[model samples]
Target: MVVPAMQLASKIPDMSVQLWSSALLRDLNKACGNAIDAHEAAQMHQNFSQQLLQDHIEACSLPEHNLITWTDGPPPVQFQAQNGPNTSLASLL
Candidate 1:
């Protein structure tokens, strides 16, 4: 089923942050030998959700259509892997 971008945007805020955080934490733990914690998971989830929202907005080709306002202005700089394999989400943020 094809979902409208605006519709998805409307629903994005309702998406379960806990579920996404838990799932992402699980994967990260497995990859990094259980280095990720609950708090870090939450931050990662926030960053991830924002990026998804931004991407959806761009795809819709209507930046002004967002239902919410970002008082912080532009989104956070996405994490880049330059510090080698020891880097953690918390450290990146």
Candidate 2:
């Protein structure tokens, strides 16, 4: 995904390269598991770091760089009990 974004960022003017890289890093971190082998973990971290470095370089090259804006989506809606009196646990047993 970072590779595609890097290519696209090159072609598109005013693209937020760092923002895309940051998102990719976040995803990679989330996907990493504690149970993964040491070799695999090292390899994954190295790849991510390299990509981040490349993105930083690309972003720095831009003439007019703007801070990336992050917007939080709407909060999840809470469900309310529509019908009725709560059943006692003892009654169910």
Candidate 3:
């Protein structure tokens, strides 16, 4: 789930607040199916889910310097010293 979220964000041309929300919502619905349902409660829950994912995405997104390489991609130079064999996109500072 974490990897999927990161991939979604990284693919964005520009991670604006609006784009982030809509993209996340679209992906969520596509992966898990639409949230719209016959019951009012279901709609409410769907909204809540979208909001929760939005919040989570924001919370997880830190400064670019704070970002780390999570996948098999090369690690940031800064990570070489502290991250050992692992590479992260952390700033040298």
Candidate 4:
């Protein structure tokens, strides 16, 4: 079943933000086939809903427009060893 863009947006505001500058939601509705089940559709809606909220929170809490500037300094010297084994994947995973 296809969900309306406004209906989905009203249900998930974060989707509104992500779709605020794009037409991703409209495209999804168009491409989604009728074979999709209710459970799958609900799951997809929930996932997008959470993502929307997360994005909204991030946007609201960001310091981009504030007086402070967010920055990422260089990694610690110990973690930058060039001769050591490549454990980047291990650490990240």
Candidate 5:
């Protein structure tokens, strides 16, 4: 599920932390038919926030020479080289 969400996020132009968390929570609830408890939901949201922040920090720490191409469409082939062909935005995250 996280992999699919990551793939989807890679194509979005501006997926902010708040947007991502809300979207994930919404989808998770929908997928589970709103069965998740409030505490569990909060925990999941917190995890996503922390993970995204860590990932963003890791990305920013990379040398300037390693570029991240932002786009509404899927990242290009050359851009995938930075992470690997199989995981386009995985490295960025």
Candidate 6:
């Protein structure tokens, strides 16, 4: 016997932040009961969801579309070693 093809369906939000934050904490529209632009709403979202932001960053993790900044710092200790036994895998080979 042959089985028929199986299909799956689900609903998704229009914005990524919706997936990032909760409907209760994130207004996105008129956050804090005032009309606001996207940046303003983003600030409001941050204000309302800083705690959730930490939780969300740790839990669900933010998508890499944009807005997140990464700072460059000194390399790891292993990289600082010039000719140590295990200086780095690249130099080893």
Q: What TM-score against the true fold does each predicted structure earn?
A: 0.32, 0.32, 0.29, 0.35, 0.36, 0.19
TM-score of 4: 0.35
Colliding pairs, model 6: none
lDDT tens readout by residue for model 6, 1-93: 000100010022323444344333335434555343334435544644565467666654533322234234432223445555546324533
Angstrom error at residue 72, model 4: 29
Please give the ranking of all candidate structures by TM-score, highest first, separated by commas: 5, 4, 2, 1, 3, 6
Candidate 3 vs candidate 4, TM-score winner? 4
In angstroms, give how far residue 34 of model 3 lies from its true place. Answer: 21
Error of 2 at 19 (Å): 14
Return the clash pairs for model 5, or none. none
Error of 4 at 88 (Å): 36
| Per-residue alpha-carbon lDDT of candidate 4 for residues 1-93, written as tens digits (9 for 90 to 100) | 245544554464456553442244444544664334344455555666677788778876754333244244432222334777644323643
Best by lDDT: 5
Supply the TM-score for candidate 2: 0.32
Which candidate should be chosen as best, given TM-score against the real structure?
5
lDDT of 5 by residue, 6-69 (tens): 4454455554654465567556666877655333545655656676788789878765324454
Candidate 5 vs candidate 6: the lDDT winner is: 5
Error of 6 at 78 (Å): 46
Model 1 misplaced regions, further than 4 Å: 1-36, 62-93
lDDT of each: 0.49, 0.47, 0.49, 0.49, 0.56, 0.38
Which residue ranges in model 4 land beyond 4 Å of their true spot?
A: 1-14, 17-36, 65-93
**Winner on TM-score (1 vs 4):** 4
lDDT tens digits, residue span 1-93, model 3: 533544454455543543454555556665665444123223433555576678778876744333454455544234445536644454432
Per-candidate clashes, comma-separated: 0, 0, 3, 1, 0, 0
**Which sections of candidate 6 miss by over 4 Å?**
1-36, 53-93
> Lowest summed lDDT over 10 consecutive residues: which window, candidate 1?
1-10
